[model samples]
Target: MSWIMPRRSLGHAISQLLLQFRIVSAVARRELQLRAAKGLFGVAGVFLEPLALICTFLALRILIRGAGEGTYLNLVLWLALGFIPFFMFADVAIKAIGGVQKGGDLYFYRRLRPLDSLMGTSLLTVQIFGTMMLAFVLGVSFWEWEFVVENPGRLVFLYLGIGLIGFGVGLTTLIIGHLLPIVAWVIKSFLRRILLWTSCIFFPIRQIPDEFRPFILWNPIAHGVELLRQSCNPAYPAPGVSAVYFWGWVVGSIGFGLFIYANSEELLFANEPLPGLDDGDADL
Candidate 1:
């Protein structure tokens, strides 16, 4: 009877996981539809925003280092790898800042939890950016007549790792922002500006002087970007990045974020009014 109960419990857990996946998938599809309708060119607009940003940065790269700067790899593929992963990370985390308020209506379905909505957004982001990266790489490969990624496995691992870090950061920020609305704004700004420059999106870590190298190394996103560049071009020089350090951030962020979310999940459904939204209260 004991052994049979254990098997039943295992089956139940698997079933529950499948059910959650279905729910998240449904939410993701709905989000895609809404975003597609709201953007410039229907579904194509999903790729447009990132592509425009990439083009702007590429122009800057060409101005600074000439059109043929990346001797180890094509400049297009090189920048795409850095931009795609970092954008996915920033988007996921920033969107999470007000996720509870935005997704409050989703709780109408008893089966849908707050986590599911966030997970759905993360899923949508991963899909969009992953597709963009692939399209960019394939286009560059065809143009250059050479395969861009030397280690496809490493590229994928770093790509997914960065997304996981974003999801974790988003989850953590979502809960914290619920307690203090101002924090959401601050974090969003920091991610967009500070993190963008610090994440090694525009340059490789090898160029940094020794004294500044440690500062850049502290950012896990930098490690992921540098490692990704190395993964694409085996000859690419990445001196101080490590997969172990990057994964450490991945595990720590997700673990801590999950802990916070699990504890404060009930607060998400409170539907508390924003500071300035009250009819008679001072807008503090």
Candidate 2:
């Protein structure tokens, strides 16, 4: 009977997991459709935001310093790798801050939790940015007439790692911001200004002065970005980046975020009225 009980519990857990996955997938699909509808070129136009940011930065780098001062890797590829992954992380974390509020209406369904909305947003951001990164890399490869991705595994690991970290940070931010709104604004500012500069998007870590190198390396996103470029061109010099350190941030952030969410999930919807309940007419 004991063994049967354990088996039953495991089977139930698996079923619940699959059910949650289906819910999240549905939410992600809905989000994509809504976003695509807003854009002029439908789905294709949704990509233009990131593409424009990358191009603007790439042009600034070329105009200010010429094409890739210290690297043998194709200049466009180098910047794309940095810009694409960094934006992936940034988009996930920043968008998560408001996910609960924007998705409050979703809670009318008994199974749809606030976390599901955030997870859906994260999924949509990752898929969109991941596609953008691949498209840009392939475009650059064809333009340069060379394939530079030496370690495809490493490239994938960094992309997913950065996205996961972003989800975690965004979760943490969402909880704290619900408690105190001002903190969210500060976090957004920090991510946009401080995090962006420290991420090594425009310049490699090798270019940093020795005394300042440690400060930059302290940011896990910096490690992910530098490591990603190194994954493409093995010779691309990455002096102090560590895979273990990067993973440390990934595990720690996710664990802490989950811990906080488990404790404070109620607070997110405590004061806000569900959409259908206010009207007293809507049904799931």
Candidate 3:
């Protein structure tokens, strides 16, 4: 019976792997279908918003030609790389949290998990926007300026860093989304504004006031932008940023998300009756 036992174990392992693959695939498919139904309008924000910002920067460049040491092209690139990711991550976080609440109808579907929905949506946004940003960067390089990514390693590291930051931000938003619905929405909006201002999207962190420099350095978006700049711009004088710090933020945010998920039912559902069901036996 030893051979039979081994065969059963193999079957069990295969079943588990298949289950996981199915879950991920299902989630991904639903996400794609939902976004697809929105047609161009849903996904257009990913490209159009960044392009509009780039055009505005280009115009500003013409207006400020002799004034600043930094070129408008670099600023546009920096903002695109930095700001686009922030918006993508933030949207993922907010939507993930809201998806859990809104997905009550689908809760009965055993194959789906709240995390899966969140992740699927997040992945969809990243895949759409990340591709657009890369294409824009390459197109700008070919058309507007002469630029090349000389160090492939550094470029990869930078991309990883930005991704981690996005994941962390998204996870944090999920936690907040669970805790306070309306407040979470407001906070999400405020955080996006703060990310834009502190991200060094249009200007260098070094250009900030001395008193604010220390606090600004602590901003994760600033670190991400700096890291991206280091990768894309050889003209950048400083050494590349420390990857450990960026990774730390990612890990810490994920850990916090897991912690929140573990206790989410308690934090999210305290004093709130289930939807459409009242504490009393009678229907509302």
Candidate 4:
């Protein structure tokens, strides 16, 4: 009887995990379908928006360097790879922030949880961006030169690490936005410009003057983009960047977000007694 009880408990845990997974997948599929139906471009705007922005940056580079730079196609590939992950992080953070708000009505069911929505939204972002990255690699390999992927596994880790940080910060941001909307808006607005200036996605960080490097070194996204480029080309140098440095942000952001979320689970949505908030927050 005792042995049977232990087996039953384990079975129950497994069943719960399976249920959560199904819920997450369903939500991800639903969002993908809904977003895909939006227009002629469909969800491809996910990639296109970043590409357009990169093109604008490329034009600027051309005007400034006046043909002294490397091949344009090579530049596109480099910037595209860098910008894809950077934008993925940005997009995932925004989606994750709205995960609870967008699916507020769905939380009526006892089985549905705030974390489920977060996971589902996160998974959707991963799917869309992962597909785009893979497609880029395939296009380069099949149509053009041999793609140089020295450390394929490490490259993937660098990409996914950015997403995790986005998700983590997003989870915490959701709580802040719910409690104080105005502050969240301000923070969100400022974060974009900050990330843009610091990430060095389209431009190489080395181009920045030596003394100024320390100012932007704090940005993990910059470290990630730089490290990712290093993984591809031997010529590019990222002396300030390392796997350990980038991994610190990935782990720290996730740990902090999860810790805060666990303690304040009840505050999510409209179910709680007291609505807690953040530094840059909006009203619930």
Q: What do the candidate models score in CA lDDT, each in turn? A: 0.86, 0.88, 0.63, 0.76
Q: Which portions of model 2 show Cα errors greater than 4 Å? A: 272-284
Per-residue lDDT tens digits for candidate 1, residues 1-284, read 67999899999999999999999999889888888999979888977787788778777877887755477778888888888899999988877776767887888998899899988988998888998889988999899898888999999889999999888988888888878878877888888898888888887787789899898888899999988888988889887898899999999999999999999989887755666565536555
Reference-based TM-score of each model: 0.92, 0.92, 0.75, 0.83
What's the lDDT for candidate 1? Answer: 0.86
Worst 10 residues of 1 by lDDT: 275-284
TM-score of 2: 0.92
Ranked by lDDT from best down, the candidates are 2, 1, 4, 3
Prediction 4 TM-score vs. true: 0.83
Model 1, position 75, has a per-residue lDDT of 82
- What number of clashing residue pairs does each candidate have, in the order they appear? 0, 0, 0, 10
Which pairs of residues clash in candidate 3, taking residues 3 or more apart in a chain or in different chains? none
Cα lDDT of model 2 by residue, 1-284, tens digit: 67999999999999999999999999998898888898788878777877888789888888998975545578887888888888889899998888988987889997899999899989999998898888877887788777768888889888999999999999999999988999999998898889999999988898899999999999999999988888988888888999899999999999999999999999987754575575535564
Model 3 residue 16 lDDT score: 85
